[model samples]
Target: MKNKSIQIQEKHHKDLQKLSESLGQSYGKLVEKMILYFKRTGIDPDDLKNESPSHKIQQLDKRLVSFLKVQERDILKPLRQETYEYYQNYDKTLKDAKANINKNLGLLDNNSEIRANHILKELAKQRKALITLSEHLDPANKKGLKTVFQNIFKNAN
Candidate 1:
Protein backbone atom coordinates (compact mmCIF):
# COMPACT_ATOMS: atom_id res chain seq x y z
CA MET A 1 0.00 0.00 0.00
CA LYS A 2 1.21 3.52 -0.82
CA ASN A 3 0.38 6.38 1.43
CA LYS A 4 0.83 9.97 0.33
CA SER A 5 0.46 13.22 2.18
CA ILE A 6 -1.30 16.18 0.54
CA GLN A 7 -2.24 19.63 1.69
CA ILE A 8 -5.86 20.57 1.14
CA GLN A 9 -7.23 23.97 1.93
CA GLU A 10 -10.23 24.42 4.11
CA LYS A 11 -11.65 26.88 1.61
CA HIS A 12 -12.32 23.98 -0.71
CA HIS A 13 -13.55 21.85 2.14
CA LYS A 14 -17.11 22.00 1.01
CA ASP A 15 -16.27 21.19 -2.58
CA LEU A 16 -14.03 18.40 -1.35
CA GLN A 17 -16.77 17.04 0.80
CA LYS A 18 -19.23 17.24 -2.05
CA LEU A 19 -16.79 15.52 -4.36
CA SER A 20 -15.94 12.93 -1.75
CA GLU A 21 -19.59 12.02 -1.51
CA SER A 22 -20.39 12.28 -5.22
CA LEU A 23 -17.45 10.15 -6.27
CA GLY A 24 -17.72 7.75 -3.37
CA GLN A 25 -13.98 8.02 -3.07
CA SER A 26 -11.93 9.50 -0.31
CA TYR A 27 -10.25 12.85 -0.95
CA GLY A 28 -6.95 11.00 -0.72
CA LYS A 29 -7.71 8.81 -3.69
CA LEU A 30 -8.65 11.78 -5.79
CA VAL A 31 -5.47 13.59 -4.91
CA GLU A 32 -3.50 10.47 -5.73
CA LYS A 33 -4.23 10.79 -9.43
CA MET A 34 -2.80 14.27 -9.58
CA ILE A 35 0.34 13.27 -7.76
CA LEU A 36 1.13 10.44 -10.11
CA TYR A 37 0.37 12.56 -13.16
CA PHE A 38 2.81 15.25 -12.07
CA LYS A 39 5.54 12.71 -11.30
CA ARG A 40 5.34 11.37 -14.82
CA THR A 41 5.14 14.74 -16.57
CA GLY A 42 6.90 18.04 -15.93
CA ILE A 43 3.81 20.28 -16.04
CA ASP A 44 2.64 22.24 -13.07
CA PRO A 45 -0.44 20.74 -11.49
CA ASP A 46 -0.96 23.59 -9.09
CA ASP A 47 -2.20 25.89 -11.84
CA LEU A 48 -5.62 24.56 -10.87
CA LYS A 49 -4.80 24.37 -7.22
CA ASN A 50 -7.03 26.95 -5.65
CA GLU A 51 -8.87 26.82 -2.39
CA SER A 52 -11.59 29.06 -3.66
CA PRO A 53 -12.71 30.47 -6.99
CA SER A 54 -12.13 33.98 -5.83
CA HIS A 55 -12.28 37.18 -7.86
CA LYS A 56 -8.49 37.28 -7.85
CA ILE A 57 -8.24 33.89 -9.52
CA GLN A 58 -10.82 35.00 -12.02
CA GLN A 59 -8.81 38.09 -12.74
CA LEU A 60 -5.72 35.98 -13.17
CA ASP A 61 -7.61 33.76 -15.53
CA LYS A 62 -8.57 36.89 -17.43
CA ARG A 63 -4.87 37.53 -17.84
CA LEU A 64 -4.23 33.96 -18.88
CA VAL A 65 -6.82 34.51 -21.55
CA SER A 66 -4.46 37.00 -23.15
CA PHE A 67 -1.39 34.83 -22.65
CA LEU A 68 -3.18 32.06 -24.50
CA LYS A 69 -4.05 34.55 -27.19
CA VAL A 70 -0.38 35.34 -27.62
CA GLN A 71 0.39 31.65 -27.75
CA GLU A 72 -2.23 31.23 -30.44
CA ARG A 73 -0.46 33.91 -32.42
CA ASP A 74 2.78 31.99 -32.00
CA ILE A 75 1.13 28.76 -33.05
CA LEU A 76 -0.14 30.32 -36.24
CA LYS A 77 3.20 31.87 -37.17
CA PRO A 78 4.54 28.92 -39.09
CA LEU A 79 1.24 28.32 -40.80
CA ARG A 80 0.93 31.99 -41.65
CA GLN A 81 4.46 32.20 -42.99
CA GLU A 82 3.95 29.17 -45.19
CA THR A 83 0.58 30.43 -46.35
CA TYR A 84 2.11 33.82 -47.14
CA GLU A 85 4.83 32.20 -49.21
CA TYR A 86 2.23 30.15 -51.01
CA TYR A 87 0.23 33.29 -51.72
CA GLN A 88 3.32 35.08 -52.93
CA ASN A 89 4.18 32.15 -55.14
CA TYR A 90 0.69 32.22 -56.58
CA ASP A 91 1.02 35.95 -57.32
CA LYS A 92 -1.99 36.72 -55.06
CA THR A 93 -4.38 34.55 -57.06
CA LEU A 94 -4.98 32.18 -54.17
CA LYS A 95 -5.97 33.60 -50.82
CA ASP A 96 -5.50 32.02 -47.41
CA ALA A 97 -8.87 30.60 -46.35
CA LYS A 98 -8.23 31.36 -42.68
CA ALA A 99 -7.46 34.99 -43.55
CA ASN A 100 -10.66 35.12 -45.54
CA ILE A 101 -12.39 33.71 -42.51
CA ASN A 102 -10.94 36.50 -40.37
CA LYS A 103 -12.17 39.10 -42.90
CA ASN A 104 -15.62 37.83 -43.80
CA LEU A 105 -16.80 36.60 -40.41
CA GLY A 106 -15.38 39.31 -38.19
CA LEU A 107 -14.62 36.53 -35.76
CA LEU A 108 -11.42 38.06 -34.41
CA ASP A 109 -13.27 41.31 -33.64
CA ASN A 110 -15.32 39.35 -31.13
CA ASN A 111 -12.39 37.26 -29.76
CA SER A 112 -14.12 34.10 -30.91
CA GLU A 113 -11.24 32.98 -33.06
CA ILE A 114 -8.82 33.91 -30.35
CA ARG A 115 -10.76 31.96 -27.76
CA ALA A 116 -11.16 29.01 -30.08
CA ASN A 117 -7.49 29.08 -30.89
CA HIS A 118 -6.68 29.14 -27.20
CA ILE A 119 -8.80 26.07 -26.63
CA LEU A 120 -7.02 24.32 -29.44
CA LYS A 121 -3.69 25.40 -28.05
CA GLU A 122 -4.73 24.29 -24.58
CA LEU A 123 -4.63 20.70 -25.75
CA ALA A 124 -0.87 20.99 -25.91
CA LYS A 125 -0.50 23.57 -23.18
CA GLN A 126 -2.57 21.61 -20.70
CA ARG A 127 -0.35 18.58 -21.05
CA LYS A 128 2.56 20.44 -19.52
CA ALA A 129 0.28 22.19 -17.07
CA LEU A 130 -1.34 18.93 -16.06
CA ILE A 131 2.01 17.33 -15.47
CA THR A 132 3.13 20.25 -13.41
CA LEU A 133 -0.11 20.39 -11.53
CA SER A 134 0.24 16.70 -10.92
CA GLU A 135 3.21 17.42 -8.68
CA HIS A 136 0.80 19.15 -6.35
CA LEU A 137 -2.21 17.13 -7.42
CA ASP A 138 -3.17 13.62 -8.43
CA PRO A 139 -5.53 11.90 -10.79
CA ALA A 140 -8.34 13.29 -8.73
CA ASN A 141 -6.79 16.69 -9.01
CA LYS A 142 -6.45 16.34 -12.74
CA LYS A 143 -10.13 15.57 -13.02
CA GLY A 144 -10.89 18.52 -10.81
CA LEU A 145 -8.78 20.77 -13.00
CA LYS A 146 -10.58 19.47 -16.05
CA THR A 147 -13.85 20.17 -14.31
CA VAL A 148 -12.76 23.70 -13.50
CA PHE A 149 -11.84 24.32 -17.08
CA GLN A 150 -15.14 22.83 -18.18
CA ASN A 151 -17.10 25.06 -15.87
CA ILE A 152 -15.07 28.11 -16.80
CA PHE A 153 -15.57 27.44 -20.50
CA LYS A 154 -19.20 26.51 -20.19
CA ASN A 155 -19.95 29.66 -18.28
CA ALA A 156 -18.15 31.81 -20.82
CA ASN A 157 -20.79 30.87 -23.35
Candidate 2:
Protein backbone atom coordinates (compact mmCIF):
# COMPACT_ATOMS: atom_id res chain seq x y z
CA MET A 1 0.00 0.00 0.00
CA LYS A 2 1.15 3.58 -0.68
CA ASN A 3 1.68 5.88 2.28
CA LYS A 4 -0.97 8.63 2.54
CA SER A 5 -1.29 11.57 4.92
CA ILE A 6 -4.21 13.82 5.85
CA GLN A 7 -4.29 16.90 8.07
CA ILE A 8 -7.07 17.32 10.67
CA GLN A 9 -7.74 20.11 13.16
CA GLU A 10 -5.71 19.94 16.38
CA LYS A 11 -8.84 19.37 18.53
CA HIS A 12 -10.11 16.54 16.30
CA HIS A 13 -6.66 14.92 16.24
CA LYS A 14 -6.48 15.03 20.03
CA ASP A 15 -10.02 13.54 20.31
CA LEU A 16 -9.08 10.72 17.94
CA GLN A 17 -5.85 10.10 19.91
CA LYS A 18 -7.80 9.87 23.16
CA LEU A 19 -10.35 7.48 21.62
CA SER A 20 -7.56 5.29 20.25
CA GLU A 21 -5.92 5.05 23.66
CA SER A 22 -9.22 4.27 25.36
CA LEU A 23 -9.97 1.54 22.80
CA GLY A 24 -6.42 0.11 23.10
CA GLN A 25 -5.87 0.67 19.36
CA SER A 26 -3.49 2.74 17.28
CA TYR A 27 -4.85 5.90 15.59
CA GLY A 28 -4.61 4.35 12.13
CA LYS A 29 -6.44 1.18 13.27
CA LEU A 30 -9.13 3.30 14.95
CA VAL A 31 -9.73 5.22 11.73
CA GLU A 32 -9.96 1.97 9.75
CA LYS A 33 -12.38 0.49 12.32
CA MET A 34 -14.54 3.62 12.09
CA ILE A 35 -14.60 3.35 8.30
CA LEU A 36 -15.58 -0.33 8.49
CA TYR A 37 -18.30 0.42 11.07
CA PHE A 38 -19.75 3.15 8.86
CA LYS A 39 -19.78 0.82 5.90
CA ARG A 40 -21.36 -2.05 7.84
CA THR A 41 -24.07 0.22 9.27
CA GLY A 42 -24.68 1.90 5.91
CA ILE A 43 -24.25 5.25 7.66
CA ASP A 44 -22.55 8.26 6.11
CA PRO A 45 -20.61 10.08 8.82
CA ASP A 46 -20.98 13.27 6.78
CA ASP A 47 -24.77 12.94 6.84
CA LEU A 48 -24.72 12.76 10.66
CA LYS A 49 -23.38 16.29 10.76
CA ASN A 50 -26.82 17.61 9.76
CA GLU A 51 -28.84 15.13 11.93
CA SER A 52 -30.03 16.10 15.39
CA PRO A 53 -29.27 13.92 18.43
CA SER A 54 -32.97 13.13 18.77
CA HIS A 55 -33.09 11.96 15.18
CA LYS A 56 -30.17 9.62 15.80
CA ILE A 57 -31.81 8.31 18.97
CA GLN A 58 -35.05 7.70 17.10
CA GLN A 59 -33.22 5.70 14.47
CA LEU A 60 -31.52 3.62 17.14
CA ASP A 61 -34.85 3.03 18.88
CA LYS A 62 -36.43 1.90 15.62
CA ARG A 63 -33.63 -0.58 15.03
CA LEU A 64 -33.90 -1.93 18.56
CA VAL A 65 -37.68 -2.35 18.23
CA SER A 66 -37.24 -4.23 14.99
CA PHE A 67 -34.66 -6.53 16.59
CA LEU A 68 -36.91 -7.20 19.59
CA LYS A 69 -39.87 -8.08 17.36
CA VAL A 70 -37.76 -10.66 15.56
CA GLN A 71 -36.52 -12.07 18.87
CA GLU A 72 -40.08 -12.34 20.18
CA ARG A 73 -41.13 -14.30 17.16
CA ASP A 74 -38.10 -16.58 17.14
CA ILE A 75 -37.02 -17.14 20.76
CA LEU A 76 -39.97 -16.09 22.85
CA LYS A 77 -42.52 -18.02 20.79
CA PRO A 78 -40.98 -21.40 21.54
CA LEU A 79 -40.48 -20.44 25.18
CA ARG A 80 -44.14 -19.54 25.45
CA GLN A 81 -45.17 -22.86 23.97
CA GLU A 82 -42.95 -24.76 26.39
CA THR A 83 -44.34 -22.84 29.32
CA TYR A 84 -47.92 -23.56 28.23
CA GLU A 85 -47.16 -27.25 27.89
CA TYR A 86 -45.68 -27.32 31.39
CA TYR A 87 -48.76 -25.62 32.78
CA GLN A 88 -51.02 -28.12 31.06
CA ASN A 89 -49.04 -31.04 32.46
CA TYR A 90 -49.28 -29.60 35.93
CA ASP A 91 -53.03 -29.19 35.55
CA LYS A 92 -53.40 -32.81 34.48
CA THR A 93 -51.33 -33.98 37.44
CA LEU A 94 -53.51 -31.98 39.80
CA LYS A 95 -56.64 -33.50 38.33
CA ASP A 96 -55.24 -37.00 38.67
CA ALA A 97 -54.29 -36.32 42.27
CA LYS A 98 -57.78 -35.11 43.09
CA ALA A 99 -59.33 -38.15 41.45
CA ASN A 100 -57.11 -40.53 43.36
CA ILE A 101 -57.85 -38.78 46.62
CA ASN A 102 -61.60 -39.04 46.02
CA LYS A 103 -61.43 -42.72 45.10
CA ASN A 104 -59.48 -43.54 48.29
CA LEU A 105 -61.61 -41.36 50.63
CA GLY A 106 -63.75 -44.33 51.71
CA LEU A 107 -60.83 -46.18 53.37
CA LEU A 108 -60.84 -46.06 57.19
CA ASP A 109 -57.18 -46.95 57.34
CA ASN A 110 -54.75 -44.66 59.24
CA ASN A 111 -52.90 -43.89 55.98
CA SER A 112 -56.01 -42.32 54.41
CA GLU A 113 -55.63 -38.98 56.21
CA ILE A 114 -51.94 -38.95 55.53
CA ARG A 115 -52.56 -39.59 51.85
CA ALA A 116 -55.23 -36.86 51.77
CA ASN A 117 -52.89 -34.32 53.36
CA HIS A 118 -50.13 -35.17 50.87
CA ILE A 119 -52.52 -34.72 47.96
CA LEU A 120 -53.65 -31.37 49.36
CA LYS A 121 -50.06 -30.19 49.58
CA GLU A 122 -49.42 -31.33 46.05
CA LEU A 123 -52.51 -29.47 44.87
CA ALA A 124 -51.35 -26.28 46.55
CA LYS A 125 -47.92 -26.56 44.96
CA GLN A 126 -49.41 -27.10 41.52
CA ARG A 127 -51.73 -24.13 41.97
CA LYS A 128 -48.81 -21.89 42.89
CA ALA A 129 -46.87 -23.01 39.85
CA LEU A 130 -49.84 -22.32 37.62
CA ILE A 131 -50.22 -18.82 39.05
CA THR A 132 -46.55 -18.06 38.49
CA LEU A 133 -46.69 -19.31 34.92
CA SER A 134 -49.76 -17.20 34.29
CA GLU A 135 -48.01 -14.09 35.59
CA HIS A 136 -45.02 -14.69 33.33
CA LEU A 137 -47.36 -15.07 30.35
CA ASP A 138 -49.01 -11.72 30.94
CA PRO A 139 -48.40 -9.11 28.23
CA ALA A 140 -47.68 -6.35 30.74
CA ASN A 141 -44.77 -8.25 32.27
CA LYS A 142 -42.55 -8.78 29.24
CA LYS A 143 -39.27 -8.10 31.07
CA GLY A 144 -40.15 -10.36 33.95
CA LEU A 145 -41.51 -12.95 31.54
CA LYS A 146 -38.24 -12.99 29.62
CA THR A 147 -36.26 -13.57 32.81
CA VAL A 148 -38.65 -16.26 34.07
CA PHE A 149 -38.70 -18.04 30.71
CA GLN A 150 -34.92 -17.92 30.45
CA ASN A 151 -34.54 -19.49 33.89
CA ILE A 152 -37.19 -22.08 33.16
CA PHE A 153 -35.59 -23.15 29.86
CA LYS A 154 -32.10 -23.03 31.34
CA ASN A 155 -33.02 -25.37 34.16
CA ALA A 156 -35.00 -27.70 31.91
CA ASN A 157 -31.95 -28.58 29.87
Q: Pick the candidate with the highest lDDT.
A: 2
Worst 10 residues of 1 by lDDT: 44-53
Worst 10 residues of 2 by lDDT: 145-154
Model 1 lDDT tens row, 47-119: 6753453776888999999998888788777788999998797865455665687688874465887898899
**Residue pairs clashing, model 2:** none
Model 1 misplaced stretches (Cα beyond 4 Å):
1-7, 48-157
Clashes of each: 16, 0
Give the Cα error of residue 26 in candidate 1, in Å: 1.3
- Estimate the TM-score for candidate 1: 0.24
Deviation in angstroms for 86 in model 2?
0.8
Per-residue lDDT tens digits of candidate 2, residues 1-157? Answer: 7667789999999999899989999888888899898788777777846576689899999999999999999999999999999999999999999989888775568788799999989966875676578675775765676457657656755
